[model samples]
Target: MSTHALGSAKLVLAQNVVHIDPAPAVFEAMKEGWARQQSARFLRAASITPRLRLIERFGEFTGQYPWQWTPAEGEAFIAHLRGGAKPIQMSTARTYEVTIGLFIEYLMDSRYGWTEVCGERFGEGPQAVFHEGNSVLHTIEYEGDPRRRPLDYDEVQALFDAADARPAKIRGQGRKGVLAALRDAAVLKTIYAYGTRRTESSRVDLVDFRRNRKAPRFGNYGSLMVRFGKASKGAPAKRRTVLTVPEMDWVVGVLQEWLSEIRPHFAPGRHPALWVTERVGRLSPRSINEAFVNARQAAGLDEDLDLHCLRHSYITHLTEFGYPARFVQEQVGHSHASTTAIYMGVSNEYRNKLLEASMKARLGEDWE
Candidate 1:
């Protein structure tokens, strides 16, 4: 059995170790305890794997029962992490913190007699000691930034035009290449227009298109609900957004055609995931990134542009069009209004307008 350790905590794996079973008690406990405690859907998804591995590694490292470690031992572990072995990315390191905190809380509750070797926050207890011990360690500092960006109307149109005009492979060796390019370009458009994350966009099935079948009228509206495996347990509610008519039309026309015709020819799968690779699996985030990179090069656009940038661009577009920040936040499923405000900054046109107004006010009617 494979196992690994982080700091004082250890993960133990056993041959045929049925770790998480669907027992009623286990299911109910996890529902009320582990999953319910986590706020973000994504965070819950990440906790399960690391904790299971931790259990496996414990036995492997010490050749003893899994739950054995002193507070000092735990602190030493943190130092080890900070030192070199696990120089994890900030995003990934945060998951480790969340997992450890939840595991400790579970142990303390007495619902399960899981032993506790340490108290206080993981970062403060063992992790801090290690951090302080290492003078050369680089601390992570948060510079607040918003998460979504979408391209402007003109830029998106230009990119589409560029993709359409990409030189054919020696003038007709294969239309498959041309069609694939067209399909990917449309995929890019759908993601930006719909404000979907890459995973959500990738797993989107052909059935998702039928959600538009009964299109909503003036007094009626339709929602596109994205469902997936929840990190925590229970009925996973859909993260849904309503679509405007124009948005619906673009998705229905361009995106639907790719699914109906092109995607099946290139990539086939059990579920009709909207995007696919030549290999027949749903496109991964890496694939989406590579596609974006190639598209940018072909379009002669700035190299800095990527998939998520389109999300930010969308927020900016709405802000400039005079939509209220609150409305924009809701449209993009932003939990915090401030998060939306960060990406959708005051546009240059708006800033200049403010300056002009200030000048006019200062100089009376003399300043034009």
Candidate 2:
């Protein structure tokens, strides 16, 4: 008969496995190995800890985790979870179920270690166990419409003003104050002004700005070439987007006076990217989020000011100013008119006024 060891202390036979006293280091290694496997599959790092905790907690009573679970044990886990007065959300439960299923599936793949645990020990494959676990998880039900609470113009403006008013505090008398307000204001402004996706907002390069003599020079009016996005693998490359003159001028002026001044000092390698690392590298999405957090806290703004909100606000601002939906869609880099139609629904007052004007003109009131 074939024999194997589950861990340093546990010996597996065709029929039974014997356990010996195992050090915590062995379990920790197992946990790290599991984390690595999941991470390799593109699971976010933020999710790894929670999934591990769930498995550990379940293991405390069951002797083994979901990966080692049988159909009866899977059912027992469900009962244990539902026994609590406070029911967990179906979405949350589903997430855990998926994690557990993946673990079992990984073990059964034969490539991992299935040759050691097949029909001789467990009658079914890993996939069979995963299906059983999924069936139990699916019984959980949640009832509610998706919640969406979009911000109003005044609320958005308040956030902007609050960002502008943030104070800087640091140690020592001569120490430069934190430019929290300015930074926050710039972040919020850029989000709304550009209608940028979060990834795009964080990735925008300084080279996107260029001189345009044909645009209006008075007031805050200048054009900017926005790096919209990459083309498909075989598609032709697209030209950079030309933003509204007013928005471009505002962004350029602030960046030139502030970011430009500070760019050289920390940029040891003099990286050409607009958002560079202190030692000269590209600014990561994490850095952008940190800046957002600082600005939000300083301005006393609510948690609703997410990066995607800027894209919504961009569409809203354009529609409010009487720009055509098609024109707005093009500027925002959306290919669908239906996607831009959401902005049209935001202001019924504008639509009503337009309707009244059309009616009056049709009735000959303006013809005279």
Q: Please list the C-alpha lDDT of all candidates, in the order they appear.
A: 0.54, 0.56
Runs with alpha carbons beyond 4 Å of true place in candidate 2: 1-116, 122-124, 127-150, 167-175, 179-181, 197-199, 210-249, 259-269, 276-287, 297-300, 319-345, 350-368
| RMSD of candidate 1 to true structure, Å | 9.3
The predictions' CA RMSDs to the true structure, in order, are 9.3, 8.1
Model 2: lDDT to the true structure: 0.56
Error of 1 at 274 (Å): 4.0
Total backbone collisions for each predicted model: 26, 1
Superposed by TM-score, candidate 1 places the C-alpha of residue 164 at a distance from the truth, in angstroms, of 3.5
Which one wins on TM-score? Answer: 1
Which tens-of-lDDT digit does each residue in 1-368 have in candidate 2? Answer: 41532321122122242336322333454456567666655666666778788767656756863335575665566567767997665565556566666655655555445434444334533333446424544542332222323345776677666566553343234455344334445656766666666556666676665555666562232444556453432243344474653533466565655575655555436455656654466766666666666655655666755545556767876777777777788877665687566533366777787888888889867643
TM-score of 1: 0.60
Error of 1 at 33 (Å): 12
User: Where does the lowest 10-residue lDDT sum fall in candidate 1?
Assistant: 121-130
Task: Report the lDDT tens digits of candidate 1 across residue range 81-141.
Answer: 5568655454444444444445555544543322332231121121221123423333543
